[model samples]
Target: AMTVFAEKYGVKYLAAVKCLHKDADALLAFYDFPAEHREHLRTSNPVGSVFATLRHRTARTKGALSQKTARLMVFTLVQAASKTWRRLQGANQL
Candidate 1:
């Protein structure tokens, strides 16, 4: 089930697995993601203009989701929305 979800989303399953083992570097390498992206993950901030949209979404939705599942769903949606906004703005440097 996890593999299916990862593959469907174009996510690196090895990275997700390595994350469970706390092997941060291996997980980053598995995704072929730049070290800068790791910084963004650590900071919980988008790399460019997406940051503004993410900030706005988080602020507007704070404390609205009481359940963990609902919060995760909201977060995923917000992330996708922010990415789309960044792409439309053509300001995604990473």
Candidate 2:
């Protein structure tokens, strides 16, 4: 499929064809999972929330936090946030 795409459109859209070829495995990785779990994997937003938590904390502290403190904060915040996260769908497939 990628070979055909590259051959057909590579002339007009060389950069796009190159990008797709380079990252095709990552782009198609979700398909390797169970169908029922794909949507859950796609929409999972806890990482965003955890980052938001880290962002808010870091922004307030600015340069006040030491590297050790920052790592501890991120670890603790993510651990706390995980308690509230929903279980994955189709977990039995795992």
Best model per TM-score: 2
Clashing pairs in 1: none
lDDT of 2: 0.89
Alpha-carbon deviation at 8 in model 2, angstroms: 7.3
Task: Give the Cα error of residue 80 in candidate 2, in Å.
Answer: 4.1
lDDT of 1 by residue, 1-94 (tens): 4446455654546667545457555644745755545554554444555556556666787947557855676677666866544222222654
lDDT per residue (tens digit) for residues 1-94 in model 2: 8899999999999999999989999999999989988888788777788899889988988859888998899899999888888887778888
lDDT of each: 0.56, 0.89
Winning model by lDDT: 2
Model 2 RMSD in angstroms: 3.9
